[model samples]
Target: MTQPMVKKMSEEQQHLVMQSMDMMDRFYDEEFGLLRSSGEESSAHGTRGSAHYALGLLIRQKSGDVERAVRVLHKVLDYQYDAPEEIYHGTFATQSTDEHPPAGHYAWKSFAPGTAYFLERTFEKVSEAFIHKLQEENNLLKEEADVKQLRQLFYASVHGVLPPVWISYDPNWREFIACVCAIASAAFSELLPDALIQRMDEAMERAVQGSVDRRLSDAIPMNTNIELMHIFITHYYGHRLKRADWMQHADEQAEGLLHEFEQYGGTFAEFNTTTYYGVDLAVLGMFRRYAFTERMTEIAHRLEHGLWNNIALYYNAKLENLSGPFARAYDMEMREHSSIGVFLYLLLGKGYEHLTGMNCESGHDPMIALLGIDVPAEAVPYFQAHQGDRLVQKQFLELCERDDPKANRNLCTASAWIGENRMMGAMSGSRNTNGQMHPATIHWQTETGERYYLRLIRRETGGDWNSHLRGITFEAEVTPDSLNIDVQLDTAEEIEVYFEIKGPSIRHQDIQPERWELPGLTCTVKAEAPEPTMLMYTDYAEIIYRYVPGKSENRMRFELGISD
Candidate 1:
């Protein structure tokens, strides 16, 4: 929704926005400028821009600056600190940057997509870069029993080999660094020299000798955590890295991480990295091997579909609120756009495929995305159905602006676009009064009982004046005893029914029990009255609830439940 009335920035606001973007550009420029190790800690924390590295690489690829991009990526291996054991790379640490040793945190793990995007774009030259490195150092790989040659060869081919538990790395994160390292090493095969490959092979065997308990006991897996993104991306790139073969223990931990991550509502709150690798993790879980369990798939679905929906906005027009963790500093200007991009990537990449193949048990057919991943589409109809109130208001306002008194004064009804068994209201409206006299006759056109909303708000006007006419009028294609519509009122009132089609029999109550639609019970001294208790029918679509004074924001939620 475009804000027709865009607030012009004052001198102060202009300066503020510029300052923030300037800071953003600078932080990302410096931290991601080099391909240093994740262990390289920055003085600035959340501001450290690993995503920038990927972006920079992307720019380089498109702009034909491949050499520089490769050079930058290569620097990641040169990252050094006082203690290599503590692999914590972040620009900002609680300790001072002077004598205090820099923490070697693994920033690349979270920066998978950005890096993968860059690598994929530049593989043409990256292929050459690997060949260059492999051919350049040919002396190191001779199979000599000499430990010096073995250590040097190991050191040459590798960027840095840290322990399984990277102190600065996220404990639950998959092995992104592993993929990068694997690619770099494989590309540099000639330089890996036969001796180096042999030495590294021995080194790898020795590396794995720590036993399952030792590796599983690790946290953050910083020492050997890298290239996982590459491995996963390899799935798309024609190389399948086996998780079960790599480290079964890590996969087990990944499942736990996924569970705990879901508990946190899909926000990687515990892992404090600027990069949103959680998106990557979500995709990784969907792979055929991991299967990630059914729970993992559900998490991915919710994570992609979930966002803050304002009822007022949803009724008016569904707009998501991007007030969540990934909002980093919360630039409302691009928050929703950013989150939506990530969600769509996950949706098209996995969700669409998942949706297309399965039969939805919810009776309604699931819709797939542009890429056609078979995933059940979230039921957006629930919100759409109730949005008639919003549409009617909009229509009323437009009529007012046009000076169409006859049209403006006429009560506008919410309209629904029903499909098969489902009923949904894309827009809504009610009666518009003229000269203080509210119009009584409202015309509603419907092929079926697809959309309906009505409420008479009473201002706590005791029993005498409280009895007002607030009836829901319906024109159903096939009329039954009653049709359900979600409703909740703060006060008690009576409804007069006038059904245009078939019988005037609308059950209004018999529906889903879990949905709890009945609100409250109170008999008032109204002129035309029948003692009807407030209905709280849960399973059914609608509710009729009594409201409390001063607490008016409470809403009658209409949730979409799609079963497969």
Candidate 2:
């Protein structure tokens, strides 16, 4: 196999890369040979962080960096639980301060294949003599151990323990199983024993069969990231192992996904998510690099560009964040270093320093770097371009009935008003909850240049507070400076309307019993409810309006554009 040619990083991209490396350096424990978990006060070493740091160091390719990276990799390998009888065998701990730690159930999915990818690229890029020197300096191998032996040792450490665990555990995520098999086929097939090879072959066959079975019975889109991973792995190993059946399956799935994308106005089911979008891009990059057919490669390129274009449209240059109505999000603000921020920082380069949370976690930075992916050049302007008052609206098809594709349900309608100094976005008709959906959100720049965020939540009083109100139908009418929301519930239950706000120097005033004014926004509730209560904390505030059971319909309006 030939090494894929990667474009040289721009000077700005290199600077961001260096910035990431510096953050890793601060969190790195020299004694433990690992990176401390980000955003945690403890001195715990993170297995994924260590692996990602090693990959970052390898990409930097500075003097002494490779030796340091090798040490980190070895330490990470030591953290994996090797006990065959254990349920957690073949996986590495999520993080640990203990020298020998128990494995995390899902850790092997990312780190194992990721580390194998690192070694595969390392072998292709580095010289044998240099590897030998690093091995000697780290005392990783005997004096006479050849490069082949060292590679075998590293591969076995990660992949050798995988088959037994994979078969016994029988994880439901076929994409991850396919990933393991694909990497084995691509990098370590020769090093693996015949028995192990047979096991992997069987696993791959099972995964493909399962995917086929699902497609036969279901037409709704799969999870965006996982589907792409499945496509890439199938196509990748299909070509590597010369399996025509797997290749055909991948092609069919790829085309189906593309059709969905076209049918839904180019947005995925998990649309505009801060965390999963990064994963989506990473897998798409893999397709560009490894898909066996030209048509698949072209599909990957088109989707990759389209996703970046969406990123640009949602990006708020003033707040240094992507505006929401996020279909899914881990953090409301990108300043906290949401996964998408990594890609934005890479794209926006020097001016995107406000996204200082680069080390928030070992995000897809390592994988993106390995794939040599970049944001489309055309979308770069929108990310940093001068902001104007504009309205962007999109409608996405979420799912359809199995019998009739035209009988579409769960249409996600989203709209955003990007202002000169503020942005507000809202979505309706989405059934996603459990805190993943922020249906209505607003972010503004205060007079003092501080950024503030406010989002709406509908919750049943005694139910899961993190989730959106269940058994309710809601729709939001959004304009340039205001949002009007109407919610209808199925059952008579105590409901809470929450306006979660986060920022500095926040103050609120009650204009009326049901109307309140904050730093840069105002809210009015028109339900059969008492006065809204303001709950203040150190870094955030929540305005809660409680309604007793009886009212099944409610209306609330939020007016933005108030100056600080």
Residue-pair clashes per candidate: 86, 0
Global local distance difference test of model 1 = 0.27
- How far does residue 370 in candidate 2 sit from its true spot (Å)? 3.8
Candidate 2 residue runs with Cα over 4 Å from true position: 1-10, 16-54, 57-221, 372-374, 399-409, 459-469, 491-495, 508-512, 522-530, 547-564
TM-score, candidate 1, is 0.30
Give lDDT tens digits, candidate 1, residues 258-372. Answer: 5544553433321211123222333333332233345434433443343212112222112221111111111221122122222222333432222122111100010001011
The most accurate candidate by TM-score is 2
Lowest lDDT 10-residue stretch of candidate 1: 361-370
Note each model's CA RMSD in angstroms: 26.4, 16.0
Candidate 2's residue-wise lDDT over 113-184, tens digit each?
A: 233224434543454555667787976655544655765565555444433222233222455435534543
lDDT of each: 0.27, 0.63
Q: Which candidate's lDDT is highest?
A: 2
Candidate 1 residues lying further than 4 Å off, grouped into runs, are 1-52, 55-60, 80-215, 218-245, 254-317, 322-338, 341-376, 379-564
